[model samples]
Target: MLPADDREIDLKTLKFVQYYIELGLQAFDDWSNFNVVDQFQTASLRYQLYEIVYSLATYQAVYAPSLRGKVCEAMRNSIEKSLTPKVMGYWKWESLLGKWSLDWDPIKKDNIMVSGYMLKALALYTGNTGDMRYTEPDSLPFQVTKNAVYKHDIHSINKYVLRNWDDSNFCIFPCEPNWNYTACNVIAAAGSVGYDRVFNQRNFERRRERFLKHLKEDMCDESGTLLPIKSTFTGFTIPGILGPVGESVSAVDTAFIDVPTSARVWSVIKHENIELDPKSGNYKLKGLSGADFIDMGSYMPSTGAAFLSFAFLANEYGDYEISENLIKQADEVESPIEELPTGSLRNKGISVWVGGFGLRARLIRFRDWTNTVVNGPPKQCINGPVLDGYDFQNVLVAKAYSPNGEDLELVLYNGRSAGSFSLRLAQLAPNASYKVSNGASFVADQNGTGIISVKLDGRTEVFTEKVQKV
Candidate 1:
């Protein structure tokens, strides 16, 4: 088993995670209330769903490997929400102006914004949990209307994304009809890499060279700065004045598949957009205009959102000093967090979409994002003891995993009122005697399942290891 100190999670960070978990549990049914309003697409339902699933999946991969059910459900809900007419039917309007016909099927054409995120979520769910439910035929159904339904699943989505890449003259396709975005394509590329990782396929590998070549040549300017948008019909590329926002987002996405390019792009962003604040002795964003300051979610000026993005990128690249400094800058300007009944917290000033970025920045370790995408979760965590069917509302799980695929470790907090709760443990050695941290011992049944009781007043840590025979 790993040392106890290695698995320790502090109370503040625990609550931060609880916040996203609680949000994810409710994301399936009621995502509209989480600030799902935007002039652009940032704060839309689909985007919010993507952010929520992304946050929850990351948490599952790193901290709570036992929470696979919750993450999978959230991913399903996100795919369902993305297929809704209101969320994806915008393609109808875009198709009118473009060469394609009005097809309500969102993923069949050039909407990488919808398809990319959905692919990422599905890939993450399957990769982390090893669940193959999404791979079934017509598992993801898009109901355009009462009679018009489009059948799709994980395989179909992957095929469509690859096909779109193959068909596009730019090699990187568009999010809307003709508007190509570097950030969105990066998301799609990362999703493709994720899919390949899970299925042991080289779909992305075959197209990797051309994708990178076009991404660098067609989407970037003379200085190698990533441009935000390009028009396929006119072949017009937007300038990189919004480099801070675009580069930061792309840095996180690109790191999943291509670490070297990600590092190089991040170096440029740091040199151009970041500076040392001599007054506070912290790193802060520099050379931002009003356009750059606008939060993509709310379309309002928010220095905090910008800071959060930079912090997220910094964290992804293992720049802890820059990440911590930028997070402090965000906290200084962002609204105070409100505690929820379940011991979770939320910021009323920022949209939930933006808040998702904050959660990622806080929880993600250096290369955790890339590692999760490229390698999936650790194999030991997948095959080891799992805490299933725990009381999510009352017991806040901080860390729950098996370090060596044989032992169990958990750190939990009282989410609400202090009380005793029961946790179901699965995947143990069958009928084996085990020692518990709470001065107790139990033997697993023939089916390799057992229940352990935990009393949570504030924080509780538990460890269960098999009793080695002489």
Candidate 2:
């Protein structure tokens, strides 16, 4: 359970998370015209899916343990969409140029940019929920044509990633055929870390030292700054690619695999990119290029996305003052918000990719990225009582968890009109009596299920503890 001081989930944060849930539920079969930006792949469906999966998984693991169903659905959908021909069709062209043949199977080859996110989403869903559905053979089937289908599961996909790493002389595999982005490679390595955690293996640990050594020695410049892209074929770093935008994003991704190094990199980025305002005394972003201001999704210049990414990095590394300041700045400058019916808040000025980052910035606590990656959802959370079947439109679930295996605590808000809403409780002790904070008592059925009605005017806090008979 969260500490008493940390129990309250603000309405803004709740709305942000709800935004992700609503977006995740929608079908992603086609996104060619959604927010197409051909130059930077950040606006692509693959990247959007990655951001959504990451945000939802983090929210479930850290805040709402009972949201496993929705989180799992979102993750599964993202994984399924990622393996589709539409989402991964670029691999055919890249493979033809690099390998002299067409390969529609994105996961089998060196497209870590796509494979890494898929693997991480799988590991997150399985590890956090203790669900093994993805572990079955041929669980993820990619249909390339009427007669061709590429089959893979969690284990096989991870094996491909590890094999790529092992075969790479640079110790860091490529996102494209010959181009390796430090950020993408870090995400791939983080996926491997999640895989080891899920299967209780030391595959990543065995290669940790070597990977870090090469990452630092071969990929970084003399000033210890992480270069953005390195050529896998020629082992040469790309000139002029290293910038504040790349460094900030890479620092956040690196936290999942290497915490100390991420912190050091963030220190440099914070110094270079952030500055203090004399009048407001709040830290603000500086020294950013026009490209940094451009929203990767819509190809339109929007400072909100850049501010959100910077704030996300600051929040990930325990720099709360800077994070808060950056967010405040973003809100002041880019303040157009759209309130959805699902109790979600969306910034109308930013792209979906930037919106996802906004949710991440709001939900993440200090060092949350590393903690959630290394040690997944707590055991008590996995085996504990879960709240379900609540009215999502009317009831905003801020915090829902069982401190032990027998108690439930929740913080909820009225999404629209304040009224009484019914909620179902699962995994309770069968036929046992429980006490609710509202002075109501109930007994669970033989299957350990019960329903409780909560009345809400604004914000309500509720807890249920099992009764111990003398």
Candidate 3:
């Protein structure tokens, strides 16, 4: 039964690999932009670039034709210089930021924790070159050339800290701030290489306990029905549904209100010490611990993500679906189901790909606001302009004309597309259903543009544009 015609398949795979590499090279002008800063966002990006090149360097036996010398040059110029001891050891400076010169700022202000995922990119990309050293301040080099890798100060996946900003509830990021997913990839991404210990101390045991306690107490009702809680991410304080964050604060404590999540709930179930109850379904961990659950007017995009991630979490924890109405709630958007993303599509109709599974979770607020004040009088307002009454999670493609007559655009970011389809629309001419199709394939490829068949063999194409309406 073991057929020996594997050559054809192997050849086909090799061709596809070659084609993909060619696409990257073509997009970058034969890899000319190797040293460019465009790709530099986190140490992770550089690390990934280098890792791709390094893999090509060693595995060229099969794909050697695609790994050009320019690629190697770019890799060397961008990442190799950052491996020195002083740069690596400095806790305040994440060497990965060398590309942008932004210096190393932790995702959150209080903790020494940097991202573990970033550290992994560095180790994988630089480990074999014997470039990393004991540069971290006060600590010795992680290694001398040819020395075995040691337990250096790196990041961990399951990191938690006590509530900062003077709050009663304690909260933690599954790994660190932003990227949220309490899954196995985090564990592997933290310990993939032979070495284990990184800069951040092991925080899993404690975080696990607190999370379970919060789930039991805040995420359920008196009868044990589950409530959608997201207090840790958003940082609103009441009921700890969101935790106390900048947005969590209002103009004044007395007149303040918790931010609202686009999601809703009809029933409240009780679990074991779920500290806070975010009535609004905000994305905070500790804040949700304090508030009582709200009955959903209906399913909302903002809350849909909570249900998705939490449902998966439940399944991971051994709970199986009994009735399956959760799916109906998740897929029920006003638009035709196939064309409408789960409120997570960007104006570009693009999905987020976080952790390793590439699921869209962390939504980006392109404008950095912490630098300025957000609330109160103009003179007192310092945080960059906090988004005004905007819920990023539920937008798909909203364009209300601005006062000046230009289109003000908004799009969804609540979740990501996870299939093999597309939705093609020629124009937004109303009184009609735009062309629709499955969007999974394009999403998985991280692509956002394509052609669509409108009728029997009839189709049209459109490029996603982040444009203002005229």
lDDT of each: 0.76, 0.76, 0.25
Across 1-470, the per-residue lDDT of candidate 3 in tens digits comes to 01011101122222222222222233322333122222222222333333333222222211121112232333343233333322234433333332233333332222212233334333332332222342343232231122322233322211212222123253323322332222212222222221222222333333434544543354344643333233454633233333221111111110111111101111111132112334733222222332222211111123333333333222222233411222223334311123223221111111111110101111101110110011111211111111122212221111111111111111112113222222332123123222222221121111222233211111212223223221
Ranking by TM-score: 2, 1, 3
Runs of candidate 3 exceeding 4 Å displacement: 1-104, 107-114, 126-171, 174-229, 233-470
Give candidate 1 misplaced runs (Cα > 4 Å): 1-8, 27-29, 38-40, 69-71, 96-100, 239-241, 430-432, 445-447, 468-470
Candidate 1 vs candidate 3: the TM-score winner is 1
Give me the overall lDDT of model 1: 0.76
Candidate 2 per-residue lDDT, tens place, 78-177, comes to 7787667666666666677876765668787677887787888888888777779989999988665544578999999899988888998887887777
TM accuracy, model 1: 0.92
What is the per-residue lDDT of model 1 for residues 1-470, given as tens digits with 9 covering 90 to 100? 11222554567666776676666566434654466564136666677777877887777787777554454566567667666666655556566666458566778888888788889988988887777888999988775554557889988998999999999999899887778888888888888999998889988889988998998898878877777888998879766436577577777887665678788877877897898878879876777775567777776667788888888888887888988878766766565567876677765566677778888888787777777778767777777777766777677777887778888888888876898888888888898888899888889988888888888998788898889532
456 Cα displacement, candidate 1 (Å): 2.1
